[model samples]
Target: MPPDSDPTEYKVGRLIDKYDLDGLGQELEDRWLGRGYESQSLRSLADWFNKYILEEKFNRAGEPPMDGEIDNIYRLLTDDEVTSGMRLDAETALEEKDIDPENTRKEFVSHQSVYVYLTEHRGASKQHSSKDRIGSARDTIQRLQSRLIAVIENHLEQLRNAGELTIGEFTVLIDIQILCEDCGSSYSLTDLFDRGGCDCE
Candidate 1:
């Protein structure tokens, strides 16, 4: 079976379903699976999703959830990587919408909190699978690597937009470097995969 959604991701992201953005998690996962994983980066995946899927959602709704005042505020409030200014802006946005910022902040949940929401509150099963290790390891590793890169890029953008992080206005560059525990040899993730894994193994 394909991996189910991670609760950690849900915690770190916007309240996906609440703002008429249902199916976003599934859409992201589905597109990433069908996309050319070897050539496409996670950032590319996100851009595609936003331009196509998210934009459609915005348009079809015919209006913002709160006359455009509550646009993405819930997400910004919850995103831990957002800069202080960004967080302030989200709170201000909420105030404009006549929502209690403190109450919303109090509602901020971590992954630990949502795990309880799922299994206990929602009566959902917690499922875990570890099978076909040899066959699936590469796919899992690549997916994880891509996810990390995209996550970093997102945080960087938040900081830059808030003027808290400066990088001379250049895009962040990331490369996955893997080191073999047994042989003390290092390889780029792409090169390692292309060579069918570590030579030491």
Candidate 2:
């Protein structure tokens, strides 16, 4: 899934539909039985569990969710919906500027909060500069977006090829990463996959 949606929602949904079932071994075999999903392998799922789920290396000890992390997720999901509103108001106050959507996208990507947003949502970084450019500035922004998407996609492919996660498990791992990055909270990898009470908190 892209970065604009709630990664938690995406991960949880996949867990319920795919990973939360019997015969996980069979399922893993089936995932690899066909060509593959995005070039992922069955071994990838095992590897992912071993690394992120079994190893539990997602966070530093004694960390808690931080401020503005929700805002970070919101920005990534809604293209900084809150920030865009605020900036539009500010732009109206300071100048006769019309709110350019492209400008807004660039601003969100450049914001310090973007790191938290990008790290978790796999494709959030791809949204950095995908607007149509009418002028040099817009064109420049598009170029940046193109380069960034390539890099992010490459990273995702590498993660997939590492043979450490299943498509389903990998999504959860990513969601955990994003949640941690956004909230600055450290969670055990086991705790993340645990369906006992893993609500958005």
Candidate 3:
């Protein structure tokens, strides 16, 4: 019920009731005039409506961008700023969907994570391949070998005097064929006691 208020304000105020920006603006304008502030144009009022009030209610707080917010999701996907696979999904969802952007951003926070994609196009969970498993095993075995070597070096003198068939330097010179057939791999033993060939017999 502001003095000199627009008819649209009163009508819109009734439509939204307790949550009416039109009435709020009218109240403010009346108060400013009462305090003798100079009148401003409706253009500024419209700007305030679009920039502050409308933006706060519908656009900010990590809400997804409006439809057509993105010109091209592919461009964002290949952008240098986004570097991980998970981030790619999130960035795309934010660009194309109507979900809150904050949650979308969280989705890409862990790229290495495994989860169901819950989309109409793809389905099902899968385990890593045998080759991947083998690679991991090899890495673990190498780490174990390095640790054993450290232990041997720490007690090198004790081991050397034990006279109990120590692996010798020449053992490392064994032919690759012999090394593979006899020991399964060259990693298991040092050349200290290799018989030079796989045909030790």
Candidate 4:
């Protein structure tokens, strides 16, 4: 790809290479195309574009600069600063659930850390586990996920309104899992949250 290639024609990979984004391209690609290197779909491209602009580029606490351009838009999604704050919040949530956040932090060191922490710690004995406690933990995780989705959607809407992102409408899909370790079973976190608990017995 030429240095002067139209920014609109730049696919996720080319953009990553041109900007030296390293692992971000692969991570975005994986989220879009799974583990395969298949052709990019409109949904994937739009999803990536929205997230890159909203989360990585746009500032929530202040107005975006008037000089914001295409180059200014492309940024590293896994930039340590972004994930570090999320990691700290995940650690705090894990501690509230009586799970040792230190080991959980070390084990799942990515955006999925919250889900991983919950799955790893859902081992409370049937006799000892309180329904109320489980319910509270489930609420916490659900709230966290919901807040994330809301923030993304809010930013996407702002971009659409501002004419920054010109793509058609799209939805953000969050796939989170809750595991019943004792029974070797798994359920969607959304379902588990709705049902109030897993039917592991």
Candidate 1 lDDT score at position 86: 88
lDDT of 3: 0.35
Q: Write the per-residue lDDT of candidate 1 for residues 142-193, one digit (tens) a residue.
A: 4465466558768888888999987653322345689999988888665565
The C-alpha stretches of model 4 lying farther than 4 A from their native spots are 1-131, 179-184, 192-201
Give per-residue CA lDDT, model 3, range 1-201, as digits (tens). Answer: 213433332322222243354445443343323334453222233223323332333354456446543323423433457657755675556545454544322222110111111001112112236677543443354345435544655466456668754754210111112146665544222222222333334
Descending-TM-score candidate ranking:
1, 4, 3, 2
lDDT of 2 at 200: 43
Q: Number of clashes in every candidate structure?
A: 0, 10, 7, 0
Candidate 2, after superposition: displacement of residue 60 in Å?
47
Every candidate's lDDT: 0.49, 0.34, 0.35, 0.45
**Residue 106 displacement in candidate 4 (angstroms):** 39
TM per candidate comes to: 0.31, 0.19, 0.22, 0.28
lDDT of 4 by residue, 38-156 (tens): 53332334434444433332233233434542222222222345566665664454345454444322222223322222222222111224656765665576457746866887899
lDDT of 2: 0.34
Give the per-residue Cα lDDT of candidate 4 at 153.
74
Location of the lowest summed lDDT over 10 successive residues in candidate 1: 111-120
Q: What TM-score would you give candidate 1 relative to the actual structure?
A: 0.31
Clashing pairs in model 1, backbone N/Cα/C closer than 3 A = none
Total backbone collisions, model 2: 10
Residue 118: error of model 2 in Å?
23
- Lowest lDDT sum, 10 consecutive residues, model 4, at 119-128
